[model samples]
Target chain A: MSNDNIIYPSVHSFSNLSLSDSSRTGFGYNPYKGPSSNAITPETSNILINKKTVSLTPTSFDSIYDRNILKKVPEISLSSFSFLFCEIVNWTRNNSKGIQDLEQRLNTLGYQIGQRFLELVKTRERIKYSKREIKILEILQFIHGAFWKSIFGKTANELEKSQDIENEYMIIDDIPLVSKFISVPKDYGNLSCSAFTAGIIEGALDSACFPATVTAHSVPKEGLPLRTVFLIKFDESLYTRENLRFN
Target chain B: MTLHSFYIFDRHCRCVYSREYTQGSDGGSTNRSNESDTAKLMFGMLYSLKNIASKLGDKEARNNLKSLSTGKFRLHLFETATGLRFVIVSDPAIDNLQSVLWELYSNYYVRNVAQNALSPVDFACDELLANPKFVSETDRFLSSLPVFR
Candidate 1:
């Protein structure tokens, strides 16, 4: 009561102000829309920014061969390289810690070489090689057709996907000829030169900028030839992004 | 002299044979038989060529061809790429010796040597000499030497 009687201008500045009328403009406003509808979703943001949107302009296969020039040296025997390769395998086996560890180490060794080989094979081919961002199917085809033919002197037996899993795919080779004469003793279960081949494929795919993981598995086919399967699996995110862009 | 066997100078070139026979009346059957005469003819023809090339410096290496008939061998000398010529003896005939000689020649041949030059042994040896273990051994050897004293 005593404060009220003092009536200070600083305390109560609106004491003398007169009331005024105001009107709201409803232009450009949707009254029925909820707050959630106006909010920017993560899904929408991803579509606008982070997705890899690329144009696939199909070019002819001639570009690959034009780049590969074969300069001939004197002929060398296959026997000349056999001992060297055998020692390389032996050396790798000696350094490996355990069986699985050895395989993993070998696989890692393969990864870099795979990258180099991809560039090499792309250039070396005379026909039906790819340069664009290739689909999984086309990559497997290129590996089966051109790459295998160049290295192993034949194509892979089968290219199939796992029935249960959408991302898993397999490249079945009837017999891995390099491992044909090789009998990896019980101690060196992890040692396999197939890792080298696996690395080659992985490198090629990575260089092409198609991200995928590849591993080699030995599956000896009965009566048929050259049996080994290289299982390739693409990351879920890779397929998802591809789906979103393509769809 | 009529020539029989000839040495190849290069991988592609052929043997030079002359039909001109020498006048040696040794009954064509004694030590101087038809085959022996032919071999002698080859030797005589090649020797002059070898001498000429040798005087020109070693342009091509000397390649010798040996011919064996009735366990007896004859020498035919010829210059290869180098002017140095070899007199081929019939002791170990050309066929058996050629392979060995070829392999030996190939090992030293510029290309094969170059191919193995970049191999791991060269790399490892260089690395080892640079390493402390090798350096320590070298130091010990040097310290124990009379030259150091």
Candidate 2:
């Protein structure tokens, strides 16, 4: 029953508090002194692809066979977060360049929250297992299980290591709550801020000093169509370590 | 007159500028529930501030407040459309006040400076007051600030 080796932090205890309580405490670190004078900027960073900034290719697969994975779990309503997210989307749309720009804006916003949440959650776990996640698989597994469960109250659908790719993995979530009530407008095209959630995963992973590239892809599994697969592509340095260990 | 007064008691941390200002009816108990909740959060902060200021002593505490601003210090509290705003100033620069006011309004607290030019929240004498709750709260907060001690 105990998966103590996992690197992600536990957020199950916050379950007792109401959503209102969570809202009051949302990303607001109220210290007696005051809010931090430092403001975090998310736009400065680049999304590295092939060790260089490049446009994401939706058709690219981490692994072909892994796409068939199935997950069995009942859906849950996270109404409070849904409302909060709607406002976040509304805010991002305020000065957005277009649909893609808006999605990027939302992704940037979520990135900081993700980085902060990981630090806070990791501190809660026991010291022996609480060390920062270093490897690609360990970090992906942490995101698929603990991070998803903490944020959405359920673990993700599946975590698969790509067979052909040197350092790639897929995290599938059957229902991303933000996408539940949302159908992107035609003008917006294929843009999705669930990609923001992927950015969060990347931010947390990178901040913990585990460098990786992450992007969100819409892959609806049978019977449940809102499935989102977060593809995490780790850098070559990661593979070098794995190879060294095996050799 | 030296105007030195100190009173020690526990449970809540509050000091009245004039003892007569301390009166509040325990009547119509429904309102008491709302007041009590606000008091619970505010009192802890006030108590901690008292504990901090007491350790600094009157001279050091007054100097600390004075250092924040160059002009005369005034304890100002404003009742906004929602919640309250508290500011302590010995001197006011238009720029400082503007930035603070901007932050206040943006934070959704509409500042209402009443005709009397006084705040709803009580502020005590800058002159030496030995009151234990006040001293304790002040001491508690000031000790934490490296700038003070």
lDDT of 1: 0.49
Encode model 2's per-residue lDDT on A150-181: one tens digit a residue: 67778998998789976778888888866764
In order, candidate lDDTs are 0.49, 0.49
For model 1, the TM-score of its B chain against the native B chain is 0.23
Q: Pick the candidate with the highest DockQ.
A: 1
* lDDT at B114, model 2: 16
For model 2, what is the alpha-carbon lDDT of residue B115? 11
DockQ per candidate: 0.02, 0.01
Tens digits of per-residue lDDT for model 1, B1-149: 22222232222222211111123553112112223455446555666654565676665775333323335544444343543222223332334444332432343222222132112222221121122222233334323534222
